[model samples]
Target: MYCPFCSHIEDKVIDSRLSKEGDVIRRRRECFNCKQRFTTYERVGEIFPMVIKKDGRRERFNREKIFNGMKRACEKRPVSIDVLETVVGDIEKKIQEIGESEIPSHIIGKELMNQLQKLDHVAYVRFASVYKEFKDISEFMSEIKSLAPQSVVSYEQNPSKTIDGVPL
Candidate 1:
């Protein structure tokens, strides 16, 4: 494997193990030139279907896109990278299970939102705000309230308190 830090093509695998789901292999490699270590994942490739955009254009499915969106939503939250990876893996498994050649972007968006909603409320709201494109504060607050029925009342009482009740 090529070393990402120095671009050298020589590396030694320090560890190799199957992921929790046993579908992917995780490898920890140490670069021969830089002595730096990095992790990589090994999984079956070229099995994902094409993604159909809202404009009716078709493109190859990209897991990095999903990872980026998830990373942005999980920003400043307690969400971990491993959690995001597992979420992406789960989504990929779901899509592959559908056994279709083409899938709509909205379907992917809905699936992502559903997963995020269960993972972290703040991340879910962040992703929803962008994916759904709320027009005003009312719509945003409505979405938030739907996620947590008690949020509206609690927020009204203490506007500065965070979701965990830590005073801001």
Candidate 2:
């Protein structure tokens, strides 16, 4: 393996371990020249379905995109990196189980929203606002109402109540 630090072509594996799920292998390597150590992960490459975009374009399935979207939504929230990683894994497994040559992008988005809704309400709304493209405050408020009907009802009953100091 090439060493990332010096771009050396030679490296020695110092240690190797399998992931708890047994789906990935982690390797600790040291550069032969600089002796710098780095870790690398290995996983079996599986064929994934092409994503049919909304614009009628087809693209290769990208795992990073999903992770980044979730990460951005969960930012400043109480969710952990491990939980997000597991959610991504679950989504990947679901896609693989579909076993189709092509899949619609909306399916992936809906699955992500479902997972986020169960994980964190704030994160779910954050993702939904962008994914669903709310055009006005009413649309945004409608989504919040659907997410927590009881809270919305209580706010409606109490006109004095405000969210972030703004009357709801």
**How well does candidate 2 score on lDDT at residue 103?**
79
Stretches of candidate 2 exceeding 4 Å from the true structure: 1-46, 149-168
Which number leads on lDDT?
A: 2
lDDT of each: 0.77, 0.79
Residue-level error in angstroms, candidate 1, position 85: 0.5
RMSD of each: 12.3, 13.8
Alpha-carbon lDDT of model 2: 0.79
TM-score of 1: 0.63
| TM-score result, candidate 2 | 0.63
Candidate 1, residue 101: CA error in Å? 0.0
